[model samples]
Target: MRILVTGASGWIGSASVTELIAAGHQVVGLVRSDAGAAKVAALGAEFLHGSLEDLPALHAAAREVDGVVHLGYVHDFSRMDDAARIDRAAIETFGDALAGRGGPLLIASGTLGLARGRVGSELDQPDPAVHPRVANAAHALALAQRGVRSIVVRFAPTVHGAGGDHGFVAMLAHIARQRGVSGYLGDGANRWPAVHRLDCAALVRLAIERAAPGAVLHAVAEEGVATRDIAHAIGDALGLQTVAVAPEHAAEHFGWLAAFYGADAPASSAVTRESLGWTPRQPTLLADIAAGHYPGD
Candidate 1:
């Protein structure tokens, strides 16, 4: 299969391209810059110079590929409307190109707020009100009815790894270092699920290879690692004390990350594992933090 992966220079996209090429598929990564092109080329994939907003380029690339793994998104919380609009346009463009074709269209989503205060599963429908991008996944899923094999891979909030992770976990560490204390919300009981980037990439490869149309999958490894535990791990790594931030001060302390850090979104991949025979062999979140994968190492 010839796969076109958007955001192919990203943390997960780079890994997914490597996984796909290793499995004997040709990969063309949609990149917006020469640096991104070089990065994808270094991973043994061809590059298509484009961004998610470039529908003509995306449609052209989509029309030529056997499948698409849509991972590109403008992740600006301040400009969520713009981000969602761009993502929705890309999904629609891909859907238009692949309608009646039955080729896989895997779009990334998140496990957060899919189920509040409990463990979320593959069957839980995303609430667009909770996050702007959820609506885009819903749109992609509707493409399945038009003969597109649209699969939504809801990634855990924390996709942690060594050296290059700039996601939530890394931001937490940076905040902790700046504050001199690792902090959690309220009583620090909120939980967050996580997965390693490589494990997530492997799952993407498997989904593109074998997952059914309209399938909703969880790219989560640990079901939930409590926020307090996570803070303790960060504190251990950074040699700081773990503290609980009150609701009134959360914004002041964590800035735009407060809402995300305070979510209790645990998710299970049992159905995904049973359906695809996919198992995550990555280190646990706490273990990664203990190993100094989060900075201050």
Candidate 2:
């Protein structure tokens, strides 16, 4: 099968390209820049030079491929609505093109802000009308109605690995470096879900191949890694103390990341594993930290 992958140069998307290629699938990776195109080509994928705004190009790309794995987003937190708008438009453009085709359309969603103080699961429905991102996922899932086999793969907050990660784990390390201490909210009892990046990529591949239309998949390796333990790991890496800070001061100390790191989004991937026979074989957060990935410069 030939797959058209958006954000093909991104962290998860690039990994997915490698996975798909190894599985003997041809990939046409959407790249907005020459460097991105070169990177995708280096991964043995054909490059489609276009951005999300180029609906006609996106449509053409989708029309030519057997499936799509959309992993791109603007990612500017301050302008979240802008990112949401772009996602919605891209989904609409691609889904419209793939309508009545019965091809797979795998999209990236997340477990954050779904619910608080509870473990989010594949059985749990994100309020389709609630968050803008949630609404976008709902829209993509609805494509199944039009004969497009759309699926949403909700990833955990922390998708960690050795390098090139700008996600939660990297943010925590950067915050610890700036603040001189590794801190968590209150007693740091809240939990955050995690997965290894390669494990996540494998799940995306599995979903593309086997997930039923409109399936909502969770890519959570360990259900929940305690925030306090994460703080300790960061502290151990930076040779600093792990301390508990008041929730109110989390913003001041941890900056923008404090808002997310302070959240308790313990997500479960039981359904995903049981349904797909997927198992993650990567080091856990604590073990990865202990492996010296966060050593000082």
Candidate 3:
């Protein structure tokens, strides 16, 4: 199989490309810049130079590939509308190219804001009115009606690793260092789900290779690591105190992280594991943090 992976130079996408290539599949990595192109080429993938808005290029690339792993998204948190528009356009473009062709299209979605206070399962449909990304995933799933084999892989927020993880965990450490106290919302009872990067990559491979059309997969390894526990871990790493901050002051105290750090986002991947025989072998979230992955120097 020749897989077209958008965001192939990114953290998860890069790891996915490596896994796919190791499994004997040729990879076409979509890159928008010279640096991105070089990065993909170094990983032994052919590069298609274009952004998600470049539908003509994306369509052409999609037409040539055996499968697609749509992993690219504009991560402009302050401008979510832009991200939504780009994501919807990318999905539409990919769907148009692959419709009636029955090639697999794996779309990336997230586990956050799925279920309010409960654990989200693979079967829990996204609230149509809420997160814009949910609708984007729905659009990809609808492609199955047009004969495209589309699967949605909703990722846990924190994809932690020992090397080069600049995501939530790293941001938390930065915040703790700046504030001098690691803080959590209210009683600090809110939980956040997490997965190791390699484990996430392996699950993506399984979805690409064997997932059913319109299948919804949750890439959650450690379903929920408590917010207080996370604060404690960060404090331990930074030699600071883990304290509780009121929910109203989360944004003021934690900066941009307040919205996410306050979410109780436990998710389950049991069905994914049973369906694909994929068990996560990576270190637990706290273990990864404790292993000096989120260093405070």
Candidate 4:
């Protein structure tokens, strides 16, 4: 199958391209920069220059592919509504183009905010009121009714690996180095699910290939890693002390990333594993940290 991938230049998206190509599928990666284009090209994928907000580009690209794996997202927390509007438009464009077609449309969603104090699963639903962009997943799933095989893959907040990782774990290392200590909020009891990027890419390939219509898959490997444990890992890596930041002082300590670090979004991938036969082979998040993957500066 020939696949069209948005955000093909991104971390997981790039890994997905490699995975799909290795699986004997032709990939057309949608990218916005020469660097992105080169990354996809190096993976032997054809490149189309466009951004997610470009509806016409999305329509044209979707019309030519057997499936789509949408990984592009504008993660501007301050201007979330604007970012959501762009994502909604892009999903709608694909939905329109793929309507009446039986091809798969796999989209990336998050396990964050889906649940608190407990583990989130594929069975849980995200409220659109909390984050407008989350509605894009629902919209994509609805496309299944129009003869499109739409699958939503809700990923853990921390998708960790070595080298080019810029996700939460990397940021925590940077914060630890900058602040001279690794801090966790309120005894650091909260938890966050995590997966290695390669494992996540494999899941993407399986999801686009065999997922049922309107299926919601969890791309998690470790169900939960306590914030305190993560803090200690970072401390060990940077040779810094691990400290517990009081809830009231979390904002000051973590800056804008405080809320995310404090969130308890543990998630399970049992359904995904059983449904797709995806067993993660990559190293765990803490192991990656120990390997000195996320170096501050």
Candidate 5:
């Protein structure tokens, strides 16, 4: 299959290119800059020049490829609404192009906010009103009815691995370095699910290859790791003290991350593993942290 992968120069997107190419698939990666194009070329993927905001570019790429793996997302938290608008438009363009073609459209989503205080599974539905991206995910799943095999893979918040990861764990490590202490919210009991970068890339490959239409998959390896344990890991790596911040002081201590640091967003991947036979064969979050990939600069 000739796959068009958006965010192909990104962290997980780059890994997915390697995984797909190893499985004998041709990849055309969407890149927004010369640097991104060069990175894609180094990975042996053909490059398509465009940003996610370019609906026409998205449509053209979708029409030209056998499948699409939508992994690109704007990370601007302050402009989430704008990012979501672009994502929805891009998804719609791809759906329109693949409507009657039976082509696979595997999109990246998140396990957070799907359910609160419990382990979220593929069975749970995200409230569209909660976030625009959540609504966009549902829109992609509905494309199944339009003759497209659309699959949504919900990724854990902390997709950890070797260096180059700038996700939650890395953020925490950086904060710890700046503050001289690794802190978690309240008693630090809230949980967060995690998966290695390589494992996530593997799941993306499996979904595009075999997932049924409207299938929702979780790319979680550890269902839940206590936030305190995570803090301890960071503390150990940076030789800093691990402390708990009161809920009232969380914002001051952790900055913008306080909003998510206290969330108990554990997720289950049992169904994904059973359905796709995806066994994660990579280091766990703590192991990866201990290996020093997240040592704060």
Candidate 6:
């Protein structure tokens, strides 16, 4: 299959490109900058120069590929509404190109807030009213009805690995270093799901190859790791104390990351494993953190 991967220079996208190429598929990576193109080329993928805002470029790339792994998202949390708008437009553009084509379109989404106070599963439907990105996931799933094999792969909040992981876990580590103490929110009982980056990349490859239309898959390896435990791990690594911040002060302490650190969005990948014959054979979250890979040695 010839796959077009948007955000191909990104953490997960780059990994996915490597996985696909190793599986004997041709990959065209969508990149926005010269450095991004060089990164994609270094990964042995043909580079398609464009950003998510370029609808014509996106449509052209979508139309030219056998499948698309849409992983591009504007990560500016300060302007989430604008980011969501761009995501919606990009997905819609791809959907229009792939509509009635029976081509697979695997989109990256999140499992956060899919279930409240319980382990989320593939069966949970994303509430469109909650987050605009969740709504975008719903819209992508609807494309399946129009003959597009659209699958939404909801990633765990923390996708950690050895190299270049700037996700939530890295943020926590950075914050800990800055504050001199590793902190968690409100007794630190909230749970966060996580996966290794390579494991996540393998799952994306599987979804592109075998996932059914409209399928929602979880790329979680560890269902939930407690916030306190995560804080402790960071503290241990940095030789600092682990402490808990009151819920009221969570936002003030953690800033934009407070909501994520305080969330209890545990998720399971049992169905994803069984359905796609996929298994995550990587170090667990705590193990990865303790392995000294996160703090950059």
Give the whole-model CA lDDT for all candidates, comma-separated: 0.91, 0.88, 0.90, 0.91, 0.93, 0.92
TM values, all candidates:
0.96, 0.97, 0.96, 0.98, 0.98, 0.97
Tens-digit lDDT string for candidate 6 (57-125):
899888998989999889997899999999999999999999999999999998888898788999998
lDDT of 5: 0.93
Model 4 lDDT tens row, 1-297: 999999899999999999999999999999999999999999999999988888987999999989899999997878988988898888888888888989999989989888767778888887867777688888889999999999999989999998899988888889999999988999788899999999999999999889999999998999999999999999998899999999899888888898788888889998999999999999999999889997876
Candidate 1 local distance difference test against the native: 0.91
Which is better, 2 or 6, measured by lDDT? 6
Task: State which candidate, 4 or 6, has the greater lDDT.
Answer: 6
What range of 10 consecutive residues in model 6 has the weakest lDDT sum?
A: 288-297
**Candidate 6 total steric clashes:** 0
Predicted model with the maximum lDDT: 5
Per-residue lDDT of candidate 5, residues 1-297 (tens digit)? 999999999999999999999999999999999999999999999999999988887898899999999999998988989999989999999999999899999998999987876778999987888888999999999999999999999999999989699888889999999999998888888899999999999999999889999999999999999999999999998899999889999889888899999998889999999999999999999999999999877
Candidate 3 stretches greater than 4 Å from native: none
- What's the CA RMSD of model 1 in angstroms? 1.4
Candidate 1 lDDT by residue in tens digits, 1-297: 999999899999999999999999999999999999999999999998987888898999999999899998887878889999899999999999999999999999988888866789998886767666888888899899999999999999999887788899899999999999999999888888899998999999999999999999999999999999999999998899999899999999999899788888889999999999999998999999999989842
Supply candidate 5's per-residue lDDT for 145.
Answer: 99
TM-score winner between 1 and 6, please give it.
6
Clashing pairs in 3: none
Candidate 1: segments with Cα more than 4 A from true spot: none
lDDT tens per residue, model 2, 141-161: 999999999999999988887
Which candidate ranks first by TM-score, i.e. highest? 5
- lDDT, candidate 2, residue 70? 95
Predicted structure 5, TM vs. truth:
0.98
Of candidates 6 and 5, the better by TM-score: 5
Instruction: Give the alpha carbon lDDT tens digit for every residue of 1-297 in model 3.
Output: 999999899989999998999888999999989999999999998998888998889999999988899998898888998899899999999999999988999999989888877899999998767877888899899999999999999999999887788788898888888889888889888888999988989999999889999999999998899989998998887789989998788889988788788888899999999999999998999998888788754
Model 2 whole-model lDDT (C-alpha atoms): 0.88
Local error of candidate 6 at 143, Å?
A: 0.7
